[model samples]
Target: MTVPAAPFTPAPMPERVTIYEVGPRDGLQNESAVVPVAVKAEMITRLLDAGLPVIEATSFVHPKWVPQLADAAELMGLLVDRIGDAARRMPVLVPNEKGLDRALDLGLEHVAVFGSATETFAQKNLNRSYDEQFAMFEPTVRRARDAGMDVRGYLSMCFGDPWEGAVPVEQVVRAGVRLLEMGAGQLSLGDTIGVATAGHVQAMVAAFAEAGVGVDRLAMHFHDTYGQALANTHAALQVGVTTFDASAGGLGGCPYAKSATGNLATEDLVWMLRGLGVETGVDLDAVVDTTVFMADALGKSPASAVARALAGA
Candidate 1:
């Protein structure tokens, strides 16, 4: 029984959407068990085979902070040697100048810097105040741009924060614009706690648009904590957002935000887009199989509803 999402025209959606697969870095980083470098490499290759255009490979953050990705250099080396030019399209998260240096040494063409929208989250996540965090990111973004590497900026806690109940739209817009001004090619707005609803998502995207940042320069990263990830994604799509950050099989949550849960599942997003007649270039069946393989590697079942149902079927 191969049940599809039943193709139908919905609200205006982008003709082609770019799915930024973050399972390898953001997904595997929170795993309690450290996945072997070879296994991690294989996951990237599998994701590429499944037609994901942009896959975040690994992070160069210190091993002390994120032990799960301690094998960042090794993993990237294996991926480059195994996949050749395809590896160039993969981006890695770099927390600061030091991390950026590590990523540069590997000749990675794309890198992302993580920032926070609220003050409390900034202190807790980046060890800097909300305004001060930009000073830290300026040099890293500048240097990465200097190296001719494509830079993506990740703004966490855009919708709401654990310490701060609801984030102001103006505050989020301000911080996001700063990142864009600092030379970030694309800014990923993160609903770190999964507290966003469809209306809130539309309002936030609209606020950014009013701030002179178009949908062309923004991406949406949502978590499924309140079961609104897909709904929120739909809202973003209706507003002309074409890039979405999704994890394979809903593999990751924010390690810093304990209340956060798994991200929007790639299989689920692809199904909705398929029904809406939007092209993601993803094979849903291949993504489900990859999730099953990774779920077994993690010694647990996948958290994605679509993956569980489709894999079981």
Candidate 2:
């Protein structure tokens, strides 16, 4: 039998990596408070000030589903004058054809669509089976790409599921392939339930590589519910994973994934990456300050340990 070559090298440091700040979109989607559209825009501005490259600004989903993001167009209008030519890309989430149309009307060129890695999660979140939800993404993704927008596809519950329990690695790979084939410029494997281990991270990356998915086109979005997020992220780095989605104060949760927490905090990941000499272009202190600002505006405390520590809280 012949062995295959490795897809990537787990080096101590690579040239650089891109971090997508999803606090405004994924982070606040489940929040009860409307968070005020002005506040949402400011949070995104602050993250960009902290050198975050790409920020998912808002989602054009039905207001009934996520009322907090009801002002998607309002938020984009606010961002237009504030984020002026800074080179920071803000991608809004579009759930269907109508959502994409709304995004295009705002002159938003970058867009993202989400589908589930599990059938059960899909049925609950989108009120449709996996195939149905993903079928919706096909035209949505293509239209975005055709409009010269960068298309990102998110495969939620990649590692485990609240309703169905452990998700198979093959299921994730297949969903990813479908999305990539649909013209998604990048694919994110989301650990929505936050039950994944570092071992699962390694295996999943290898499986995608085996299926011919390039590591460069992949991004990991891990939740810290079980405190395995950073560890799982470390394992992903060892497999040559680079791009990742993070929230400013560890402030996000999946309404679909029961008990899961916010994303792997941007401050924490910045600390780790900077300590290892990997360039993420993020200012750890700035991120901490931004989190503090977020906490004050939301009447809450910063969720990231690094943010609190660096803020001297």
Candidate 3:
């Protein structure tokens, strides 16, 4: 009999990573049942306590679009005092000029604008064509920057679209460049339907780099629909991407894309990163505890394998 082949080797990875926790906003936005403001505030506090430096606090989207997050303003009011002295960054999602106005009114310091790479998703999600969406984003990004708030842009469906299927690498690069040129300080490329493979991840990052977008100014946002988020994260790490987006308890999915599942779990990412000797500055045990608490509130076990194993132990 032939001897077993040697284990596969991974590419080089960064020493440290910035885990951009999006549980409070992207994680909870897709919930059909409304989460109370007090619970939401507690989740944010718990995540901060777990040492997540950058937390996406909430979305200022209209209630008609995301009724689950209708208490965004109230939630912010409750946490404003606690967040003031903390050494953490809280960014809220603002869909348009109106959304930006609401966030600015609350004296928020960081905000994120969302765009779609494919025309089908753009029209379906934002009710605007691809170009029209950028037109809306320009004014919002400029105004947010002028107000001294750091602006982050999210480019959705970067890899594959449920309707369009297999989004072109060039298409994603073009949309990302426009967002950067429009004054977004950072851009998060999203695998909206969780259809991206490790090879796709590597090529997409390379394509963006070739198009003049530095890895430092970019972040990867993956969903685990096909169970590839962690693998995709590994691929991205090899390409020198230091920032990643994850949700606690693996919460949230894309409402528009039925196949989309929960985002990559922060606990899972932390576990993998720790095993690789990567520095995330986040306490993994604390994150597990936080997700357990959130799972209790949501009346279900956490979707994270790491959290589930630790809880059982």
Question: What are the clashing pairs of model 3?
Answer: none
Best by lDDT: 1
lDDT of 2 by residue, 1-313 (tens): 1112322334654657899889888888867677988788778888888889888888999998888898888788878877654422578888899999998887777889889988888888889888998788888887888889889999998998877888889989999999999899899999997889999999999999999998999999999989988898788888889898999899889776657778999888887776566788887777888889888888888888887777766
Q: CA shift at 81, candidate 2, in angstroms?
A: 2.4
Tens digit per residue, CA lDDT, model 3, 1-313: 1111432335567888999999989989888788899899889898998899899989999999989899988888889866663412489999999999988888888999999999999998899999999999999999999999899999999989989888989989999999999999999999988989999999998998898888999999999999999999999998899999999989988877787899999999988887777889998888989899988888887889999887772
User: If scored against the real structure, what TM-score would every candidate get?
Assistant: 0.98, 0.94, 0.95
Best by TM-score: 1
Query: How well does candidate 1 score on lDDT at residue 309?
Result: 86
Residue 104 displacement (Å), model 2: 0.6
Of candidate 3, the 10-residue stretch with the lowest lDDT total is: 1-10
Rank candidates by lDDT, best first.
1, 3, 2
lDDT (Cα, tens digit) per residue for candidate 1, span 232-252: 989999999999999998989
In model 1, where do residues sit more than 4 Å from their true spots?
A: none
What's the lDDT of the predicted structure labeled candidate 3? Answer: 0.89
Tell me how far the alpha carbon of residue 236 in candidate 1 is from the true structure, in angstroms, after superposition. Answer: 0.8
